[model samples]
Target chain A: MSRSVTANLKTKYLVMTKKVIFIILALYTFSSWSYAGGGWPVPKGGFYFKLSEWWLISDRHYTDAGQIDPNITSGIFNTSIYTEYGLTNRLGLVVYFPFLSRAYVNNVVSGTTGDLLIAGDAINTIGDTDIGLKYSLTPQGSIKTAVTLTLGLPLGNSSGGSQQNLQTGDGEFNQMLSFDAGTSFSTKRVTFYTNVMMGVNNRTNDFSDEFRYGLEFGAGFLDRKIWIVGRLTGVESFKNGATAAQVNSTSIFANNSEYTSYGAELSYYLTSKIGFNVGYASAFRGELIFANPSYTVGVFLDFTK
Target chain B: MNIFSRAILWAIVWSFLSCIGDDIIDDRVDPVLRITNAIDTMEINTNYTFEALFLNHVGKEEVITLEWNTSDPDLMRIDPDGNATALAVGVVRIGVKGIAPSGEAVQDEVPCVIGNSTVNNLKERKAIVKTTSSYLLEGDAVLQEMEGGFLKLSLAENYKASTALPGLYVYLTNNPNTTAGAYEIGAVSVFSGAHDYELPSEVKLTDYDYLLYYCKPFNVKVGDGKFED
Candidate 1:
């Protein structure tokens, strides 16, 4: 009888633990959904939130002569949840949290000896989160342009492994000044929109200043319920000052790493406020970079209060 | 509306306009043009060539021209065509002037060493190896007989290859008797052979020249009568 009681107690304890674990998982999922599901800076005055996954494909591995190797490909995966609060019709504030996974393989050179391998754990913590203030400079009926000043804080795992050419965090504080210009035209059945963004990044020793520019084009379909989008992004970085030993070390290919990516995304809205998005991106070509393609899947909820 | 309320509304409108003006001003600032490909210390004889591509500003390829100058023009000289020639064995400062489309110019400089070539007796050679007649390979280590001829080697394996811009000469020779002197062959035609050529029993294999392999930007020259292996 005592053994039976003990067994019953054990069963109860297991049930309680399972319940707790289930609750914890549900809460975590809910929180992530809330974080990523909303916010895009809209025209004039509405709070917006967006959760997005960006996959960087084709880091662009090249031969010593700077010729691109088609076989060598790699990239990073980033999941970001951001929210924007409209202070006024013309001004807004935004906060974003990002998680990253960086992986790569090098197959450019002959022989298996020169193979470059880079893999790291997922950085789910807040990485170089950006807090920014955006204000509309020009607001026409159909066209609008905005300027943003953002402060990027190194709050994520900056130093996980030396192999992280796919670094989750740049390990330094940075400031980015950006400009975004967008325009939209709609007909009875379709809506067409395009946005161009340019950013200037200021970084520290382990990092360098960079210029990032991108163009996003999209069209809404099926009574504005489905959207197909294409984007082209390019980045150019200045070289950091290397120490004498670093210059002598042949492991690091630190000269002129430039990359460009092109991608297409399909998004479907289930309701007026909820949607799912998936995308595929590839680095068309690059120098001193990895080579590969990246993919993204995300769900979003958008609303205004 | 009362006069006071009307005045407050106008003030709000004016404030909004001022904010818009400020934002435009921020966006109009000249974009910082940073040269990411500047070299700090370059060896003169190292033969390095890099490209400068314009970014941010589109459709303005002609607007930017790169002008390079050396600190010691006697030691090194850079042509307007982006060619760097070593004048003497010495250290020199190399400066690149970037002329923007707007007539604005930016300059960057670096130090470089030009090494002197100690061996000057290197001769450029070209070789063409052709079968005297159609040859075939039935299987591995099998023999397919054809017309007998000697192969002329174009490059020696021991010569250092140029890493930068490289030039290659390939030709075919028909004269089998002239093996000691440089012989030029007429129009060479390339086609798929019915069978691969087999080594002749009378001819020694050690006299054959091996092909030289080189990575890009580096020029490779093969030495006389030397095999790459």
Candidate 2:
């Protein structure tokens, strides 16, 4: 194993013992940010596309101090398309677009009077989109490495509902630079791959810049037709941006959200090129973020296979 | 079903499940009968008409028939219409009782002394605001009557709150359990240190029994301060 892959394995083991905490931000944005790709860029003339739905319904959230506090039940759903196509021998193009996004808050009714204290509201719109270019740093090596530069486009409703607290986006354009390194190995029958990622997201509109990292491990079974993947991702805020007291907007998804989460996914290939996947993720610790599990279901077409 | 068809079915089910639902909250508060226009003292042979406000279980004010009485009817007699006459120089307790819409009995009483002149019972009230949730919120707050019938609510310098708490708002309310009928002061912009909010002339210093801190969007109570009697 290469030094970087070995180091990543050690780091992953250490983080597993420690508690994960921080905020999972936006609707569809951060959910896909850490799961973009591994170290290998798509091969020349290769293409991979996925149609997925992701949702989160929460009745509480972690306070700034990492303590859970009750909140009105709220939910967000995003139906998105993610695609990656190889442009050259070492370059690839990536796109993630959520064409349908819905965010809603439950109606608050008085238990004693059976009267509506606050009416529920919902908004339907397109969520933010991300376009990126990934370049392979080492096309021929035991340990593969790649770098990706993703541009975030603010396209969804930042302020929705009567109180302007329901949001589908952060309303700020951001640029993220990330690096990935991974290696694959086979143990008798099981094919295993491990990857590590690190990134820095520079955000505009007074939103805090964030440092992102993750570790992903996948093992294939049944003649490499079924794969089980486990992931650990985290985002740490720089906290240099404007606070709620300094900002004029009464946005409930305020800045400086941080969280560390763990997720598991099961992927089954019905054929050589067609597959389906289901995933579940939740935070063990968080601040200024919802305290609930998120679910994802998707079908993919892999021309690269 | 095929894997693709199953995935599609799951997505459809998730969409159906995402529909809005109702969240019932326990907002029941004790019904209260309060004398809105109260006096600390009344002059001998003076006539004054007292008014009382009845708040229901949810803290919404409702018009209800209140029975008025005086402790020493010989010294000061109050009629059923709340009309009072001080006949002698003495101290007596004026009481008003009412039943709420939920059939809960409530009453309030105040001590009145027959003196040289009738004095309005207006005084500054203070309370220590503390968080009822896990969020960091605490401070000293004072509500005082100003000239022109305005009320000035001032927070002490030691006040500090979690800036990450989004949509944090302040209000003056009789019930601290909910903000359904509370008078919204405004969104809270000052998270720490001292700040003051000027309430309109219509809001009296004694109008609200508690200062409320709520998250407007989440519709949850964050903190509250009960006025020290």
Candidate 3:
């Protein structure tokens, strides 16, 4: 209604989500532990394939000027494929790409004139892609441990749409390596498991690198036909990126963005080795990031022999 | 974990979300209008070029088009760029208004009387000065071309400056933000209040489009105004 409110809302809904797609996709694609790509590496000649779609919308943000109120509603929709194939009993190859990604903003009307003050916009393109390798540390154990290394490709459009606020990707290349450990306990009807992971991110092109961590719990439902999981993730950036105050122009994606988020997911297996995961995630606290919720759905195929 | 403990954990997580602040930006700033020369009244049959100041939404003063009007057109009349001519010996209100590209509006008014002629005055052209970037570099300086080739640039009393910023230098340039084509004018001695800058006749006001204040060492833009006819 007011100008400041409107400006803040516009940036939150439109601008914050522009580059945020990369991080959101990162979490949904690679940061899985408890409900991940079979934590310990698959057997030799085994494979796992997954397809995920994510939708994110926000009317609020944590900016350089602190938290902003809701005034604008911005959204992003992306669908990507994640695939893994075991090279040996202890090693595997991974590939991830959000081939179809779309970013958009809703129109804003003036209260006085009922006329459009800010017109709506939409842009569709490919999102950033990733490729990696995973290795198992133990052949067989009650407690499993593994490690992963991945490289990011700047395949998405960083400068797309009518305004700069309509971008679908972060324009930077990065690499990350992480350590993960998990364990499970069963009680006849359900098997509950916990996993923990920590990693270091390396970046280039004036963007800051980061340290990432995740902890999660998962259990089986309906005679092991379904799986339900809850996860918590943290991202701490090395505050060395650029920051500009103008809501429409400056790129906050390169700035020091930090967040702690929580999520819940349900995976229904229609048949052995075939399933779908549906989930919702939200950042309870963050800086230089959107303060909103994201929903995700994925269908996967598992080949175990 | 048991169902009761899992439920408790989720409730605790949801409660911690209260710490998340939701305010985005403070306000949509209103463009401002200031009169640098500070004149209240004029005599009949006399002509004066009114200098109305303006600042954009970012708190940075910038040049903009303005339309002027008078409450009593019979007593006094104002042109589009704020040029006023006293017609009758009566008090009236002169106002300036501007609308932004986004349809945001700003306006200001002042009181003046048209009485008897006081003195013979020279007819001079005037242009309003504006800051280039954001962060509180705002003021309206009036640049009046003298009878000779020399010109006088004066900062209005309402001018505001960025605090604690050093190495601020002023220049006349063909560009708005850069000093590549600038004619060095020297450091900014004052941030606010009325101040004057004497310009050389070699380069006419038409030589460039902007009067810029930049930090020499940091290459940061402090503020600036444009030279207009």
Interface RMSD measured for model 1: 24.2
Candidate 3 lDDT = 0.59
Q: What does candidate 1's lDDT look like per residue over B1-229, in tens digits?
A: 8432443344334322321000000111121233223343445454445334332122112336677677888887777644677667777777666866555565656566666442221122233222221111011111112345332232222222211111121211111211111122221121222222223344322222222221111111111122221
> Candidate 2: where is the Cα deviation over 4 Å?
A1-35, A252-254, B1-13
Tens digits of per-residue lDDT for model 2 on A1-305?
00111112222223332211111112223323323464544557877777788888989888888999888998888777777777886787878887777888999899989999888998888887788888878756667778888888888788888878777777888998888777776665666777777889999998899888877777777766777777788788999888777774755364788888888877777777777778888888888888888888788877753
Could you tell which candidate, 2 or 3, scores higher by DockQ?
2
Candidate 3: stretches off by over 4 Å: A1-38, A245-254, B1-38, B41-109, B113-229
lDDT of 1 by residue, A21-119 (tens): 000000011011111111123334554455555544443344324455332233344556656666775576767666433332322231212222122
A-chain TM-score per prediction? 0.68, 0.89, 0.84
Query: Candidate 2, TM-score vs. the true structure?
Result: 0.92
Worst 10 residues of 2 chain A by lDDT: A1-10
Measured with C-alpha atoms, the lDDT of residue A270 in candidate 2 is 73
lDDT of 3 by residue, A1-305 (tens): 00011111112223222210000113632112112233545456876666666666666565433444343566666666667667987786777776676766666543333444345666778777777777877435556667788787878776565545555677777888877776665566765667777887787766678888887776665655676777788788875653332212223343456788888877776666566667888777776566777777666666633
The candidates, ranked best first by DockQ, are 2, 3, 1
Q: Say which candidate scores most in DockQ.
A: 2
Restricted to chain B, the TM-score per model reads 0.31, 0.91, 0.43
Fnat of candidate 2: 0.72
Could you give the interface RMSD of candidate 3 in angstroms?
A: 13.5
The docking category that best describes candidate 1 is incorrect
